[model samples]
Target: MPRIIDSNDKNLIGDKVKALRKAKKMSQQTLSDRLETMAIYVCRGSISRIEDKSRTVTDIELYGISKVLETPIESFFES
Candidate 1:
């Protein structure tokens, strides 16, 4: 089976992703589809996990998200 995250580690970008997705009125499936356009194929369940802080996201995925959401990578780090 594939590994996701260590039980103790949280997806740091989860909250940010959720907030931004909501602000853009995008659903998890929609976001996943958008990522696919950028050559990132994260499934809908994976996106739910990402937004819930239960899964890990790659740097490339972050890049794709930044582009699709039209948000700067820096925003993910903001408080």
Candidate 2:
């Protein structure tokens, strides 16, 4: 089965990512560098866009990010 995530869900997830990164004292550039080492080409602008609810991140990208951030996908949804 295919998983479908809407834009609002993406935004919620993105918000969580941003909050987590901040809590970890990481900047967007630092996160981008980590993603780069994982072969994920995401720029700081993209991260900012995602955090600002201006971009819809793909599931694969989100998975990669979750791993790099040392966080589980469920963490992004835990309110």
Candidate 3:
């Protein structure tokens, strides 16, 4: 199923993903490595773009990030 995400959700999700990545002490390259192993093709540049709210990430990418961060998908939208 497709994840229905609003524009506001993009910034929120980006912030949370960035925060989780930081908490894990992982660089965007490391995160990209994990995603690549999961068959997701997000690059370090893409990660930066997403985290900076400069790009709208796809649900598939979000799923990959959720797995990398060990977080649930809904957590991206949580307050």
Candidate 4:
């Protein structure tokens, strides 16, 4: 099957994720560790890719990110 892309980027939440993580003074590795506690196995490099909009995020990963950042999932799309 071919890949489908709706936007120029792989994901929509990359900038927001980066902003939120930085706001919390959290490193990519730290975020990865926190997500691990939730059984979400996104590694530091993946987290970097997520922030840079180079990776597609799964719903579960999104949920884990929101919980780790203490932000609602909706916030990821907010301006």
Candidate 5:
């Protein structure tokens, strides 16, 4: 059987990421630049999609985000 994902939870992490980014007073472009510095080539639009929960983030990308934001992956998933 296929595992069903929760609709509400789909955006939880993304929302958290957005919140953290905003709390840091950082812009999406800066985040993208940081990701690039870490060799993660996610564009600004992709970041936007991520913040809005329209895009699914990969493990590597998540790692990059965690590192850049100085936040743990667990924090991103916390509701």
Candidate 6:
């Protein structure tokens, strides 16, 4: 069967996430650890996948990412 989403990318904010994370000099494991504090569990491997656009992000995960990155959720969608 074919996939529901045709695009190769799994999420829209992956690139932005990578950019912001690097701008803050934050590592993937650090991001994951921080997210865990908010009760959002995304492992370092998963975060690497997210940054590579190979992982889907839930709403709650996105919220935790924004909080940890200190970025607005809308900014993730911005070009």
TM-score of every model versus the real structure: 0.86, 0.82, 0.84, 0.90, 0.88, 0.92
lDDT for 35 (candidate 4): 96
Off by over 4 Å in 6: 1-6
Scanning candidate 6 in windows of ten residues, the lowest lDDT window is 2-11
Model 3 sits at a Cα RMSD from the real structure of: 4.1
lDDT, candidate 2, 1-79, per-residue tens: 6447543444667788888899889999999999888888889999998888788777877987898889998888799
Clashing pairs in 4: none
Tell me how candidate 1 scores on lDDT: 0.89
Query: Model 6 Cα displacement at 35 (Å)?
Result: 0.3
Q: Write the per-residue lDDT of candidate 4 for residues 1-79, one digit (tens) a residue.
A: 6557665689999999999999999999999999999999999999999999999999999999999999999989989
In candidate 6, which residue pairs clash? Answer: none
Tens digits of per-residue lDDT for model 3, 4-62: 65544445577888899999999999999999999999999989988988778888988
Q: Positional deviation of 76 in candidate 1, in angstroms?
A: 0.1
Clashing pairs in 5: none
lDDT-wise, the better of 1 and 5 is 1
lDDT score at residue 45, model 1, on the 0-100 scale: 96
Local error of candidate 4 at 77, Å? 0.6
Backbone clashes under 3 angstroms, per model = 0, 0, 0, 0, 0, 0
Please list the residue runs of candidate 2 whose C-alpha ends up more than 4 Å from where it truly belongs after superposition: 1-10
| Candidate 1 clashes between residue pairs 3 or more apart in a chain or in different chains | none
lDDT (C-alpha) at residue 68 in model 2: 80
Model 3 Cα shift for residue 76 (angstroms): 0.4
Highest TM-score scorer: 6
Superposition-based RMSD of candidate 1 using all C-alpha atoms, in angstroms: 4.0
Model 6, range 1-79, lDDT digits (tens) per residue? 9977789999999999999999999999999999999999999999999999999999999999999999999999999
* lDDT for 53 (candidate 5): 87
How does candidate 3 fare on TM-score?
0.84
Taking the tens digit of each residue's C-alpha lDDT, what string does model 5 give over 38-78?
A: 99999999999899988888899999999999998898877
